[model samples]
Target: MTARSGWVKIVGLGPGADSLVTLEAQAVLAEATDVVGYIPYVARVADRPGLTKHASDNRVEIARSQHALSMAAEGKRVAVVSSGDPGVFAMASAVFEALEAGPDAWKDLHIEVIPGITASLAAAARAGAPLGHDFCTINLSDNLKPWSLIEKRLRLAVEADFAMAFYNPRSKSRPEGFARVLDLLRETCEPDRLMIFARAVSAPDETLSVVPLSDATPEMADMRTMVIVGSSLTRRIAGTSHVYTPRFVAE
Candidate 1:
């Protein structure tokens, strides 16, 4: 008989609603011998008789991923949960980072990445599908990359007239970066360009507002907020929150 070996399953818990968690993800969560993730994400999983939850602080993604990898290597079914889709600016990449740096034997381990509703998509739906045509997503956090690089990408995305969604747009420590981003947007786009700030989507405090670029303020967004800068063709339905980009490409 083949020896029982451990495995890792990366999962996204969705935004904030329990119903948002997929049935497949829930099954993996139920069968998990060890649940590992950041404190808030781990808290979402209910206490169960056979499951052990391991919660750690934010910003220590590599170490946390290694912990989950180690647990799974010991024959435990481990689920590393992230708030949104793991592959989208979350723990999935961190796990792969750890795996690549670990021994070749680790490569033989079974690993599965289960997708879930990401914040950007949820926020986009709350608004009117500004991403209706072509779009790109950016992670504005300078933690992993430099600010100059982010600005360059932002400028290029605008130059190409792509509808854009941003993750980690701002935090308490990096407040000024987002302000600079706004300045960049104002440089290449008109004052009336549509911008949407969707905060805490699906949660009780959820607030989504569509405004013109001139009216956008730095304080309007935070780490929990998803910012979408509309293309030249994006517009709103006069008096409603509805905003969308036309399907036809513009010259």
Candidate 2:
């Protein structure tokens, strides 16, 4: 399966599990002459003939995107792999950013972005649909934004009483920022608000924990975790701790 030369495919590999990857992404990988992505994601691709893998460290998205574009310019079929949906905190935007900011020649390259199963959706599926109702997705990493702005959004979300899915809850250098989020939730939400800590969803090392905001701790989450906070209408079933927000509100 040979992809046509001189194109770039920004593709998602899903959260984990080869079966979770979309057939379209798989087709592109089969035809790719070069694959570029973060180390873990590139590793997901099977080793095969005629496929050159280029893995890089995290936080170098722009550099990685530019490298893929350069390869495409040289008439290489390049696929940039991203875990989960490429458009959701992944490589799609980075590739486009590089194309827009790079030399004018890049605009002529054929670029396609393929989506995949994102972490939040996977986590919610595992946790019995805590996000079944109105919700918002927030990337808690302040790497690209200010902490003050994040805090403002946090308060506003709580004020609106919307269920929330948070990505990149805790990074090595920014562990304290998540702690601050917990504090804000404590101050703004009820003590019994349900919070779900879902880590590495669909992977072998996956873990899911549901607890009240009173018992929820920062240590439960890490960079790979997605935190889902239930809204005011969220509740635990009578016989168990399974939490969910109702699809319809009662008067």
Candidate 3:
């Protein structure tokens, strides 16, 4: 796509720290005349000097997108920040949705997405290579999706023997959701399935642990946690912190 003059770059700030942001994403943030995002995401880049910031609540996605587009329309280099990879359940979708819903003038604004390490990838690496092979990611949040649909995807991932990474596993009001997901997985997966739980990945209070699928409980997971369920092939090497997915020819 041709880069438009007054463009908006939707940048991912990575999981939790400023050091985790990609070089390209950081450059965009530094050059941006305006930065718009959710309050926490905006705070991630708070140290940057002289950048106009627009912070909004989590529920105001459309308004955030519109503001970015409006700023770009006025010839500002805008960066809409998202925590983690923008293309993965972040602000990229909202930015495009706004473009499609707004005036054609908004279409002329150059839209670019700068990638960053998603929480799933960060958590997986920290907990060991639980996603070293083919894997699937699902969000357990039922706010934007139906519970039946989430259930179906969980079953599909289990039956396919894909390592699974779950985001937004549980929240205050949705306390029972992660436990129910575990119950469904237990029905289809072996008791020995390796699972890793990572909380506050890449942050000061980060915690990681590996356990068997049958042993994981809702108490072990929260909204800040990323759950990685290993496939049948996943194994941990003794005396090492690494868990690997084998990729060798069978004898």
Ranking by TM-score: 1, 2, 3
Higher-TM-score candidate among 1 and 2?
Answer: 1
Question: Which pairs clash in the backbone of model 2?
Answer: none
Q: What is the lDDT of candidate 1?
A: 0.92
TM-score of each: 0.97, 0.96, 0.93
Worst 10 residues of 3 by lDDT: 242-251
TM-score of 2: 0.96
Model 1 misplaced stretches (Cα beyond 4 Å): 1-3
Per-structure clash totals for the candidates: 1, 0, 0
Candidate 2: list runs displaced more than 4 Å: 1-4
Error of 2 at 111 (Å): 1.0
Candidate 2, after superposition: displacement of residue 52 in Å?
0.3
Best by lDDT: 1
How well does candidate 2 score on lDDT at residue 122?
A: 88
lDDT of model 2 at position 159? 92
Candidates' C-alpha lDDT? 0.92, 0.91, 0.87
